[model samples]
Target: MTRAKVLLIGLIVLALGGVGYLGFEALGVRGFSAGIAAQSLLVLIVVVWTGSYLFRVVTGQMTYMNQRRRYREVYDAKEREDLEARFDALPEEEQQALLQRLGLDGDDVRADS
Candidate 1:
């Protein structure tokens, strides 16, 4: 697993451990007993919930970051030029439709430059 995934798992573990400690209080666990069994079950629920969310959240973040990175890597002058070249080859009517779809045909659209 990636570092981010590992970190998320570690966070989930710590959260679960905290929940377990809380349960131990409810179950009347003392210093010698350490953990209360009944409360420990509740702790399992917390661990499952948090771990599932952590897995999904961290994975989603990583996927999004990777996608953006890929887009940046592939988005450059050549791609723009290629798109423009293709657009330029189209007839006026088709080009107008394309530009409209791209929001590039707006009459009032102009840079502040």
Candidate 2:
């Protein structure tokens, strides 16, 4: 329901109207008696309009999902940083015990030495 989505929907409606008018004109439908050609054109317009609307809906959902994922990533990173800082502030014995419990012994890896 954003302004851009509204504008796009309006544009699509206008395009469908224009195409329907042209179809009617091309079919030479002068009077109230519409033929199969006009009906087929109407169907085509409906199909195209529906497709455009669905596309907008799908893209909007995807954008929302992506935004949510990014926000979660940022939030999780902040939380992790806070947790790491708290862990680092603990005594060495407590830190070592916690790391061992988590299967991350400090003495298990030594690349600089």
Candidate 3:
């Protein structure tokens, strides 16, 4: 993570801690109990956030995984195009021979199909 992100997160946590403390105080909790309650609230929030992230990962909904999937699709498409171009550049007799060697009929080798 970047330094700025770390600093921002630290500030957020501090703010949440203050809010938690004030909330518990408003409920008549004081001193050590209020401090503990605030800390527990923070821990609960962190646990829920982490759990949601894990759920996204396990369900294959993560942005990083999506990006990698898109990259693979584009790379495979380019590779397929390159292969077709190379095959098209071959002499007619060589193309026929290749089809024969591969046991693929000329009419059945359309890439889109």
The regions of model 1 sitting more than 4 angstroms off are 1-19, 31-34, 37-81, 86-113
- Give the clashing pairs for model 2: none
lDDT of each: 0.69, 0.73, 0.93
For candidate 3, the per-residue lDDT at 106 reads 79
TM-score for each of the candidates: 0.30, 0.53, 0.80
Q: Which residue ranges in model 2 land beyond 4 Å of their true spot? A: 2-15, 18-61, 107-113
Ranking by TM-score: 3, 2, 1
> How many clashes would you count in candidate 3?
0
Q: Each prediction's Cα RMSD?
A: 8.5, 5.3, 2.2
Worst 10 residues of 3 by lDDT: 104-113
lDDT of candidate model 2 versus the reference:
0.73
lDDT of 2 by residue, 6-53 (tens): 899779766766666667767786534344555567678778978986
For model 2, how many clashes?
0
Give the per-residue lDDT digits (tens) of candidate 1, residues 1-113. 69999899779767766666766766778653545554466567777978986987877765677788778878875687797688668898997786688778635333411
- lDDT, residue 83, candidate 2: 85
Model 1 TM-score, all chains together: 0.30
